[model samples]
Target: MSNPIMMYTEGLHTIPLEREGIRYFVSSNSENCKNGLKLHVEVQPKDSPSRALPNTQNVVAAEPTSPSGSAHYGHSVILSILLCVIVVLAY
Candidate 1:
């Protein structure tokens, strides 16, 4: 084990991770464990080599979108109003 690496994903994706000479294929839908996010590690025999899948088509990356300013401001206003209401009710 090493220092934890943080990763964020917006949709279904597969991540390839190698640790301690073992290869792991982790899916986004995998379950979490107490030790942190769980990894589905796959160990290959020392006599055999890892194989790569062949791709028949090219892949394109999607463009990232910026957040809207108005949406953020609206959220802040709602949160502030809720906090004020909570304080009033507490008294």
Candidate 2:
């Protein structure tokens, strides 16, 4: 078996099921796993491949309206500090 890719970063869980004599492990995210056990395998509509859902908590939201003209001032200060650091390193 190859290295299993982690589906969930937290609350990792699995449910074992036998479909057509094939044992399979499904994630806790599935409806069957989410809500109690499903007695039989039901045909599901063809679904688009799943994509990783990003965590909103980790997403950095854009600064809600940077204080008017503060951007230029912030940039100038950062640049000045960077230049000073470079000069000090050079010496």
What does candidate 1's lDDT look like per residue over 1-91, in tens digits? 3333544557656554433354533334444543366555665544433454455577898988888888779978999999999999999
Best by lDDT: 1
Question: Candidates' lDDT values, in order?
Answer: 0.60, 0.57
Least accurate 10 contiguous residues by lDDT in model 2? 16-25
Which ranges of candidate 1 are over 4 A from the true structure?
A: 1-50, 83-91
- Tell me the lDDT of candidate 1: 0.60
Clashing pairs in 2: none
lDDT score of residue 39 within candidate 1: 52
The clash count of every prediction, one per candidate, is 0, 0
For model 2 the local lDDT of residue 91 reads 100
Please state the error at residue 48 of candidate 1 in Å. 11
